[model samples]
Target: MKKLINKLLVNHSLIYKLFLYIATIILVVYLFPKGGQFKYEFQKGKPWQYENYYAPFDFAIQKTETEIENEKQQITQNSKHFFEYNEEIVERVKNEVTQKSTEVFQNSELSQEEKLDLNTRIATILATIYQYGYIEASSESKIEKAAITLRKGNKIEEIQPYKLFTSSQILNFLNSKIGTQPYTEVQNQLLNILYDAIKPNVSFDEVFTQKTLEENLNKISYTKGLVSENERIILKGDIVEGENLRVLNSIKNEFESQIWSKSNYNWIVFGYTILVALAFLMLFLFLRKYRLDIFENNNKVTFIFFNIILIVLLITIIVKYDAQYVYVAPIVILPLVLKAFFDARLGLFSHVLTVLLLGFIVPNSFEFIFLQIIAGIVTILTISELYKRANLFISVLQITFVYFIAYFAFSIIQEGNASNLNWEKFLYFALNGAATLFVLPLIYIFERLFGLISDESLKELSNTNSKLLRELAEKAPGTFQHSLQVANLAEASANEIHANAMLVRTGALYHDIGKMDNPMYFTENQSTNVNPHNELTPRDSAHIIINHIIKGVELAKKHHLPDRIIDFIRTHHGTSLVYYFYKKEEEYTGEDVDESYFQYPGPIPFSKETAILMMCDAVEAASKSIKEPTAQAFDALVEKIVNKQMEDGQFMNADITFKELQIIKKVLKKKLKNIYHLRIEYPE
Candidate 1:
């Protein structure tokens, strides 16, 4: 079981990578829109590309949106208003008026007969006012022909609430009934009392009104008519307007909703799976062909796929609900992030594949693809230095501008006019651009998560003010100066060979940090003639020398340096034999020596940057021993030193070409001559 576990652990990269691809394929295939692709790609006002479309089955001719809206409005306008009767309000007002009338008659200076007549008249007027229902005043003078279930006393009577009277109508009725002149004071008092008592006893019932309106509207059949099977719906080049467009749209909707057999749906799923699988396959091939290092590193490949899946999943959700704002998803961030860690080519390729997959879900797939592809290209072009704060801002502006222009152009081509451009979409474009600026922090987070080093981190590490490098300089000044020269040589060669110069330079800066452990034991830091290694045996000295790689690795981890920089410490020696100590031991003891004791425990330099560092370290350290730094001597010394390391097979495992090594040798010779002030000969 332990052996099995070890085997699995050794080959975990292959296992997880396979799992990632399978999982991605499953996720995309499942999340993809299940409906079959609409066969025809016809747009409104554009000439049809296909032959005449015939009705597949006898289906209803549904109404257009405009027609449906108009019908709904008519139903609402014609629907009767509902009102509920409140007898309590009417009775309360009537009793109060009667009490007031009694008080008035009691305090009157009129005769008893006249008081009786005034009381009777007041009673009659109250009855009449209560008989007619009043409504809350509205802005429009609409006559509400309403029915009500009257709640009079304990008896509930189903009757008309009586013809509804507006405020003006009620005032006119009162004026006519209470005639002018003969008993002006009594009439005026009676009219004033009635007006004050007239509150709206009938209230609108919104719930019942809405329910009735919906029920009536539902009764209006949406299906106006049906078309026979095999009927020619519309001809090629025929304008689909008015009733023809409605029928065609109804056919489309019905066609979409029709359920197929389970087996047929399986076929649709299979087809969608093929398309999605192809998209991911393209990405895998791209990485395999052009970026094999990233392809081999499971973490890097995972980050790329994660970004792709995240973008696709977000777009899927957006299209599932509101597709109008799909453009606001910041899909361009995929390219920007990929470019940050890797290069522009990989970033743009991943982004294009992701956008194409999303194109299957978004509405107007053509326009969406066009807009997103253009934005992605712009992102790749404009975003050169991601670590620079201003570059990201400017790149985002360029991406947004590209989206704006592309969308505007596509809209013009489709709509044939700038007048109908969707000005609101520009807001979504700007929002997407602003959101893309968030990729900077995202790059940092991914760098931490995957144990990957980005250029931004490289720049920070290259600073001499950093705690680890500063300590190295302070404790061992000679070693620190040697590291600086090595960094310059490595960076120049890296640039010439099209490798990462910043990465190599950063690695070179911290490569010999372990030498700070026993500064005097190393020659560069040994200021006096007294040697620490002289008192120690050759084996002990070799052991100390070989352990610097180990100690350097420990210090780097303590200071929280990244793994990429730590690799330089691990591989700078590249398993080369420490010939000085081994030869010294052979001469003194005159016995067989174990080569392993004098060799570095190395997993060698596996990348070009690390390989370049190995060469630079050897060249710079050997140059310090050169007695006269002349041009011919410099050339011979560089060739001899580098050739010895090459013969020892130190660079075999490193992914450095012979030509790149040649370039490194040239760079080292020129840099050393410059350092030693070796002047060129001027012939007469």
Candidate 2:
């Protein structure tokens, strides 16, 4: 039992990866639509790929989106708008007008016949205005010069509304009606009082109108006609066009929607799970084969998985809400982030696979996949350095352009004209490009969350004026200068062999920071002829020399440097001996000295950058001692040192090839000869 637990603990990383893959597969499969898929693939302009197709069941032909939209719009346009006739308002206006007219006539200078005739005329005019109906002010736009239907009690009548008036317009309407007739001052006063008493008797029936509109919209037939069973839809080698295309799509929809039964639903889910699992498996296999270094670290593997899942979830959610906006989700962000942290190949590969999965959910699956895959390729190719703001902006612009061009090409092929292109999709692509710029800050966020480092961070760390590098210059000027020379050499060597020059240069700058603890013990910081190591025993001097690696690591940690930079300090010396003191101790005692006391505690170089630093560091420090530098002498020195380090197994763990080492050796020799001017100005 104890042995089994120990074995489990030893292989914990593998187990974590297994669990991660399974969980990712399950989550992505769950995100897929539960509906079963149609087996046939059809396109409008392309010939039918399947055998002669026929309607297997009695399913009705479905309407296109444009057809459905047109139907609903026609319902809104042709259907009459209804307005309510307020009987209460009309009745109130009648009583007030009659009472006020009687009061005004009581003080009139007219005889009874004149008063009665005037009262009858007023009543008739008010009745005419009310019969025409005054609509509410808020409903003006709904009945905007259009014919309105007036509903009074249980009766409905359609009216032209040529004389409709709101509350504000009532006074002008009353004046218009009475301005033609001669009237007494008392008669005019009564008309004014009746004007205040009348209210808008017509109001838009908003609730009823909306309810009717919805009912009409719902009653619209989504299916125009039905296809009989066993009817030949289209023959093989026939281009699907017009009604034939519509019928085929209708049958596919009906088949997919109707076939989702209890037994088949689980089968669909299982099939999706298998496909999704296979995609993830391919990604893992590619990582293990091509990126073994990244594959070994579980953190990096988890970070990669997180990025893939991030894009998948983002696109999936947007598609679920409205598939029309799927292009605006910024699929290029996946490759941008991965390329920033890892490499372009991995980024592009992951993006392609993830997008293929999204094709199942987004509208226009073929167009979407092709556009995104091409965009991913463009993103990886254009953006070499992510730290520069201008580079990212330009790359994003290029990526957006690629998206636009690919989509335009596809649109023209299908529609056969640029006029038929959906220009609205170009706006979405522009937004996608704009959103891709967020990768710069997003990378910083990833760096913080995952404890990862990127080119941006490396650029910042490589700055010579930073706090740590500045301190190294102040306390140990010679070592600082030595680090600078090593940085230049390692950077050049890295570039020569197609390795990471920026990373190698940055690592070289901090590799000797450990020597800052006691600068005089090493010869580099000795300005005056006083040596601090003369009074101490050989072992003591060796101990002080070896402790610098430990001290540098502590200072780096104290200053919160990333672990990637700290690895350089730890592995620069690679367990090589402090041979100067060991030889002196042997001469003084005439006996063998213990090698352990003179050796640096090392984990060796584990990457191309670190291994290059190891070679350059040793060569640069040793070259300063050559008094009579020559081409032959520089070549001999570089060869001897690199060969000695290789013999000591210093580069066994590093991912460096022998051919790459030869290239680096040539670069170092050329650089050394150039430093001392041994080589001529022109190469032979």
Candidate 3:
């Protein structure tokens, strides 16, 4: 059973991928809020374009947000504030005042009768003030009316029209009754005496007030009067004003909220499944037809599907939470990122599929799809050569502008006037464009996650200032210069043949890093023409030369260079015979020599980029030996050397055509001639 399962997994991998892809999309769709989707798209202050609407059943009209807010305001304003009577505060103030009066009388030089008269007056004044409630001034602003409880010995009575006194009012009442002139010092003394005694008998009850307000607000009906079955709700061409638009929106919401019958749900799910399946099927078919390379690789296929699903899921989340800012979701990043690694067509296609899936959940499906599709196309057109920093900035700018234009045009069409256009939406577009700039960095992350390479990474690796390449120039200037010449030749040839010029150029730069290990032994770096090979036997010299390839692989691995770049080091020599050393060995021994002793340890060039690097390396090095340094001599040198390498079956594994090889030969001949100061057909 396990063997059978393994066989099934291997044999039906594409089917499994398709199943998973479909399942993921369906899962994301199910995760979205199924009720928010509305069939008709409407705008306020615009005439209803659809046919006359009617209520099919006795459904209540949903209230507008403005109406509900107005009702809540009424509830808040009319709700009476509750106040609790604190008899302890009143009694404490009275006791404090009595004690203060006693202290003042003791400090005064008045007789007992005068002090007694002053105490009696103070007691009368306190009684007058305590009769009214003293509330803290801060609480007075928050209360419209207060429910005050007056108590008289075991009997409680509720009072209305009770005037609450603030601290200032109490002081003012005391001063007016006690007389302000001639006894001003006494009055001031008494005011300071009463400062600590003033307290609020009535305190605002926030919990009670809030609870009452909420209960009142909850009593306000959310739904207005019901429309009977088959009643005409609104006629065609009627301008949807505040109340009418609210009713229409409410009916639409309630209609969408209703669940399908249990039996009918199967058909609904089936229909929804078919629609989504068709959309994804179109995307899959597009890949299968035009992008079979990506379709064949399961990782690339998974990456595409993952991006699509992620974008859709984000839109779904936005739609469920806040649909107005859906434009801020950075949908354009999809095309921008895909185009960064892949081509414009695949990027644009994937973006369209993502937008189409999102349309099911967002309001106004047609407008959403139209705007996103146009923005995606703009993204593809403006974004080119993303490796350059300026290109990304300019491309994002253009994409933002396109989004603004498309949205503005749609709004004008929908509203029939520019006056009603929501300009704030353009801010979301700007944010999206800014967010899309992150795709540049995200491209690096995607490369690591997917084991893919992009032009931006290639450009960075190709920099001469890079640590490894800089070390190569400093340590082995001769080999460094040779690598540069070969890079130019390979890049030119790759471009002519419609190959990855950046990849081939990068490969050429690092192809000869192994020569850096023994730069002095190579003829290019020797200043005095002292040959290192002279002291060594032919076999020893051959051994040193052949070991460079192996040393290069180790160095490349140590430097953490990509395997693609290391491939050039492994295949550049391509098991070719070291002709000079082998000939010398034959002359020294006068016997048939072992070919393995003279051949490079190689798997040979298995790709066009590595093959091109091999040819350019040999051609550039041999061109320096041309004594005449003329165009004809350079041409002869290039052809003779390239033909011999070809005859040795070095290029058998490389996926290069004969026609491409001829183009490469022509480019190399021209480049070599230019190197020798010969004026070829192509000008500098």
Candidate 4:
């Protein structure tokens, strides 16, 4: 069990990576829409490029969305309205009138016979109002309906609303009923009484009417016709329009709908899993072959996979809700963000792979994949110097424009006319462009979450007035100035070698922070030329010199600087000896000494940028030591120092080549000559 545990513990990072890949693949596969792909691709007005196709089985020719929408609209226009004639309300109102009649007419100066006549008139009007039906017409949605269905008890009748005495017309109808005679006070009183007593018996039954409307709509067939088995769908080179388009769409529906069978479902998912895994596998291989540092760093690898999954999950949810908005997913943000954190090549590669995986789910796989990959390419190529806000905004705007142009071209090709292009899709592109601007904040968030660094952070750290740098400057002004010179030299060399110049420059600025703790111990900070080293033994002096590397690392951590910047402090001297102190000790003792005491403990530089810092740091510090600063002397100094470091194999771990080293050497030599006011020598 112990041996097994040990074995399992070994290659922990490799284990984590494998798990991440498998988990990513599984999650992406599950997010995919559960459907089989239609083999043939066709569009309206476009010629069918496939060979002559025939129906494999009989299938209903389903209507297009436009056709379905049109049918639904027609149904809505023609559907009848149903109302329930509430007889109970009419009875209640009539009972109230009857009970109050005696009280109301008691004050009237009328004979008993006249009262009887007035009561009979009231009863007659009540019967008439209920018989014809009075509705609150304003509550009805359709004001000009030709007819409405009235349900009273178990009986149903169709009647015109316009012909009925509506609630709005109650007063006019009552006044007209008291007709033609000059209006008497008693008649006017009775008219007002009737108006108060009459209630709308016919009320719109929204629930029942909607139910009936839904039933009618449901009865409408979605499929207009059927294509028989072995029917030819379309001949090769024939335009897919009219009947041909409908038939092809019917077959596609049949194929997609048939994916419900367990066998087919499993098989389809299996195929999807394979394709998704392959895309991720290609990404892994790319990282391993080209970006081994990122490949080895599990956090960065997880960060990449997290972005891919996040994008997929976002688009999947959007597609599940409404596939029409899938294009608005801001797919270009992936490339933009990755490029900010990593490099352009990695960013573009990851974007293409992610887009390809999305192709499995988004509608119009070819078009979506093509547009996203193009936009991603645009993102990687056009966007640079992401520390600048204007650059990101401008690049995003250009990316949006590319999306529009490509989509318009595709639409024109498919429809064979620009006039038929859908304008709504342009809104989606605009939204996609807008969403891409969120990459700025997202990069910052990822930077914090993954403990990663980006150009923006580098720029912020490169400021000379930052807290840590300021402390270094005030405590050891000479070392701070030395750091600035080294920073400039490293930056120039890095630009020449096509490495990350900003990262190296920032790293160079903070490399000497350890010298701040013991300012007088370093030669640069020794203002009075007080020989402190002369009072101490050679070994103790060497210990103090070698101790700076260790102290720098601690100071960097205390300052919460990014590991990338701290790397310069750690590896600037590598494992090379403090030769001046070591040689002095050896000359005094004249005996063998433990060489380790004179050396800075190091992992050395492990990347091109770090390697460039190492070279620049050594060259800059050594260049200041030259009393007779001549062009040839500087040249020889650069060559001899760089050659010795190379002989010591300090850069063996770094991912830099001899050609790049030579270029960096030339840059440093020219910079050193320019610094000392010596003219650069030209080849004769």
Candidate 5:
């Protein structure tokens, strides 16, 4: 049992854990009953109780009656002091007339005869009415008929008035016939015009009847009663008691009968557990291939334990708070933090697996899961290469913008209330963004505890570490100076090629560290002293120089530098033969010597940066031995060496395309030219 427990605990694949978690959450959600207290009254032995509970016909009628009564009162007040001069009404009528007349006249496409005919006809009608003195009489007849129609039982629709007199024509006639006056000509004329305008269509008997008022009042009262009844029903019964106890009890009983008692919850829980377990297993398998370090450090086991605890805590929080769905924003920070500390591929895998797991746990639709994944991916990608805290903050702000856009899009698609933009939503989004900012510190701590080093940490290490430098200074000062020069050249070259400058410099610092074992064997350390290699054969001399690569690897492994620094120590030479010694052997033997012995045992340059370092180291060292170096000589020599290396295919694996190599050659030529400028010989 203990062994089984240990095996399960050590499983690192996120899929396995995800499946387990999903299964557990499914069990919990399935077993747990949904809904809170019911919000309606329960009637015993009533077949139509539910219908009655929602019915609001009486309330609707009451509201309708109240509205009609208000309308009637407004109309009565408006009609008081009939025929009185209303400046607003008269101005409105004049504006309408002027607007209509201008519109008709501005139709220039109409023939002049047509335009004149229309105007003349209107004038003729007005003249005839004025001459007959019928305006005053007609206005009185219209007003009286309108008042009588209102008094009758007929509705406003049934008492149609003066359909032939268009609003524009009435306004035009009123303005032209009745000029502006207080009560003498203008007021009386306007009244006569209004009366004549309305008289032809009035239903005098209907308007004068008392029964019309009674009928309107009855309709209004009936509508008010219906509305009141609905309102009362909405607030009917011991609402608090019924909703809290009886209705709630009925819903609970229904759930118990339909789901719990039927063992549907059990089936759901079982299915969920199986699915979750399967998901976790798949995740474990996926991660195991790339993240073997987790297995080596027992992190897999610890992670499983942590996940279990997290799951339990989350479940507790969910149950206690009755949370509809988890706030998935916090999970987005994890992948970013992981990618910053670990390999990007591993971080991406973890991100995808976690999102899938969360999707299962979350109760929302598939869209929510998709949205969460998108947000997480954006957040992670933004900060994946971050080497500074400021970048993380900037990424957080970017993620905040993405989240708002995504949320708003989701709301729009869901047909949610988007117009109700309130402070709460702003505050919620602000708090979520702020929460992401806070995640950085926590991620930092977690990364450190996990023995993970971010790119920033590696950069910091490059600047501060001086153990190799100090060792070189004490044991091989000459080699130290040579290493410094090589570092300068390599760093510049690496920068030119867009390679890692810090790695190049660090690699240069330690590339010749093996010389500390026998400093006298190297020419750089033999200042004002006997040449050690002069006594030895060229083969033996080349052997000592070639052994440094192997010796450096051994020393670096002992010091426990990372694989990248070790790779530099290994590939810096890239199998190029020691030409001087090979030439000397040829001169001595008067024949070609064995080329294999003269060559440094090398796995050819595997990366662009290492290839650059190899070229720079050779160039910088060879330039030092040139006596009275001129710009032309230096440029020729540098070009010759670079071309030889290129011919030898030393840069084949370095990913240096031909175009980049051409640019590199030009840059080197310029640098060498600057270093070896023309100068006049001084008198000795």
Candidate 6:
């Protein structure tokens, strides 16, 4: 069973597609009978049964009322004993003042003046009650009359009432009575006064009058029963007569019977899915027409595998996110990235197909889908011809502006209000724009790992990494100088042809790397004294000269330079003969030497850039052999060499047409003529 599972899961053959088809058929079978499976539901019934589950209008109204009632009840409960504790504290203080006044007035050891003064103080305290609307008492207020007023006054009615005080005020009042005094004796007297005046109000009859816990619980139960009764009344259904019951049963029976019937709606989804898949496949084919050549080279399998990974990644994104915005990310970035590394028409076609698929997958809203397509089309168009990182950055900025405008357009259409303008929306726009910026570098990395070269790769190749150039300088100075001249000449011609000039220049720099293996055999490194070729036959010298092209290709492969650079090394010499040695052989042998042995391995240039490099290499070498430099001589030399290559079919495989080749030759001639022009004589 495990082995079967592994085969089903891991196999990528046609059997897996068959398994997927069967699984999808089973899923459709199960899902079709489940009503509302893909539709929105507003009510819960059986776990999978369809019912509208929206909150009813009556329920919403009742919910609002219930919340309001709960809030009012909370307020009432909180205020129930809010003032009771404050009343008790005030009564206790009044009683204490009365008892202390009586004790002071009745003391016989006191002088008559002191007794009169105490009596006057008590009278003054009692008189001030009308002015303050409450009896203000102090430590000395203990006369019998004041005690009578406190004991007899009604606790709820006669006490000078104040609103409930907070806990902090009560503690402050108590502390004032015992300031700097031991609190033990003072507390006992205060407790005695509290017991006499307030304890009566707090007894079983007065303080325990509120409802008990059991009573409140019973009330809650009765209230809940009443609410249930109300709900039952509202939702109640009436029994039907015999004929009505038969009609109702007939309707339900029809619904259950039709639940699993064949659906044109499901067919629509399946048909659209198949159409989208075919459209994308066509787009892939259209974009890769040039890829037929690559495919013929036995790399088709790798190419197919790479595209399969891209398709899977796109599909996974659609399934996992299922958001309208998410679909845009892949469609916008993937096509442009494909164009950058592969071909442009394919990118455009892929973008169109991606938009179509997104429309099907997220069928409801067109606003987000339209915005995404616009952003994607603009971004891809902006970066379509980019060949440098700075160009990419500028393109990203342009895309960001387009994205901002697209998002704002969406907001305007969705809300029909300009007030939606705010920093948050701007922030979201900027963040999404930044996300698009991040996608470019990631696409670069993905292409790199797949053995695909992008504009970034060409730019890096153009830059002379100091370390590698230094190695070339130390080991092969003559090859280094030759490479530099070739780079300058090729770069100029490439610019004229509108090819990738950087790639052309960089390829020229390393094209002769293999010449370093036998530096003296090449004329560039030979000293006037050392003539190794003098002892060898002309055929032997020619063979050694042509071997450098093969050797350079081998060294290039070892260093893992991309196929673009490798092609430069192979084709820069084309099938052109080593003319000097060929002439030498003709003179010495007096017989036709096999020209094939003297030619560089003969798969000629395959691109405009390579063809230009080939032209530059020949012209630069021929210029070095010129005894006298002159504008007419330089022009004649360039024209003769290019015309010879054209007649010999060296440019046949290259994409450059005769018109572009002519332009390249003219540009090279003009440059070389200037370089060889005689300096004007200055009057002495």
lDDT of 2: 0.87
Tens-digit per-residue lDDT, 1-684, candidate 5:
999777777774554645545555565445333323233324322222333343322222223333566877865544421222223333344454445554646744556775565455444544333221222233444443433222112223322234224334555565454444453432353345443433222122324343445455454442222223233232333332322333333343333334343365566556656655665555556556655555443444344334333444563465347543354335565566556655456556666655565544444425556666777778767774466778878887887777677767655544345773333544555566677676556655754565444566555545524676688788899888888877777777777777666667777877888888889998888877698888899889989989998898998878766566777888888888988999999998999788999998888887776887788788878887889877777777778888899889888877777776766667766776676677779999
| Cand. 5 Cα-lDDT | 0.59
How far in Å is the alpha carbon of 65 misplaced in model 3? 3.5
Where does the lowest 10-residue lDDT sum fall in candidate 4?
135-144
For candidate 5, report its TM-score.
0.50
Off by over 4 Å in 5: 1-325, 334-357, 365-385, 408-453, 473-502, 525-530, 588-596, 626-639, 646-656, 670-684
**Best-to-worst TM-score order:** 2, 4, 1, 3, 6, 5
Residue by residue across 206-320, what tens digits does model 3's lDDT show?
7876887788887889898887888887888998776677777777887678886776666666667877778888888998998776787778888888888888888888887
Candidate closer to the true structure by lDDT (higher is better), 5 or 6:
5
Q: List clash counts for every candidate, in order.
A: 0, 0, 0, 0, 41, 9
Which of 3 and 6 is the better model by lDDT? 3
| Residue-wise C-alpha lDDT for candidate 1, range 1-684, written one tens digit per residue | 999999999999889988999999999888887775656655555665679888878999887766788998999887866555577887888887787767766776778987777677666655665674666675123344454444444554555644555566777777766665564676677778878876777656677668989999888777788899999888888765666667767787676667877897999898888888888989989999988989998889998998898898899898888989898899988888887788889988998888888877887777888788888898888877777889889889888888888888777766678998888899999888888878878888988788888888888889999888899999999999999999999999999998888889999999999989888889999889999899999999999988888899999999889888999999998888888999999998999999988999997888898989988999899888889778999899899988988888878877888988898889889988889985669998
RMSD of each: 5.2, 3.0, 5.7, 3.6, 21.2, 13.6
Candidate-wise lDDT, in order = 0.83, 0.87, 0.81, 0.87, 0.59, 0.58
* Candidate 3: stretches off by over 4 Å: 1-23, 35-56, 66-85, 95-132, 140-163, 179-196, 232-248, 259-272, 279-283, 474-476, 493-500, 516-551, 567-615, 633-670, 678-684
TM-scores for the candidates: 0.83, 0.95, 0.78, 0.93, 0.50, 0.62
Candidate 4, 369-428: lDDT as tens digits: 889999999999998899998998998899999999999999988888899888999999
User: Which portions of model 4 miss their true places by more than 4 Å?
Assistant: 1-6, 99-120, 140-142, 179-189, 678-684
Question: Residue-wise lDDT of candidate 2 within 256-334, one digit each (tens)?
Answer: 5774679888888888998999899999999999999889899999999998888889988998898889899888889
Worst 10 residues of 6 by lDDT: 221-230
Model 2 TM-score (2 dp): 0.95
Model 6 C-alpha lDDT per residue in residues 1-684, reported as the tens digit of each score? 999989876655445434433443343233222321223211111122333222211211122334446755765454222012234544564566677755644644556885566455434433332221232232113222211112213353223233212223333443443233454443445434433332212111223224432244344421111122123221123233232223323333333334444585476446645664465456436534745454333232244334434544554455456643343343456566766665565555656655554443342325445666676677667774556557667776776677677666655654456665544645655566565556557656765666666676776666666455666677778778888988998888877777877778888998888786777898888757778999999889988888888888887788777887888888888888898999998999899889886887867988888889888888988898899988778889989999999999998888888899889878888888776777889999
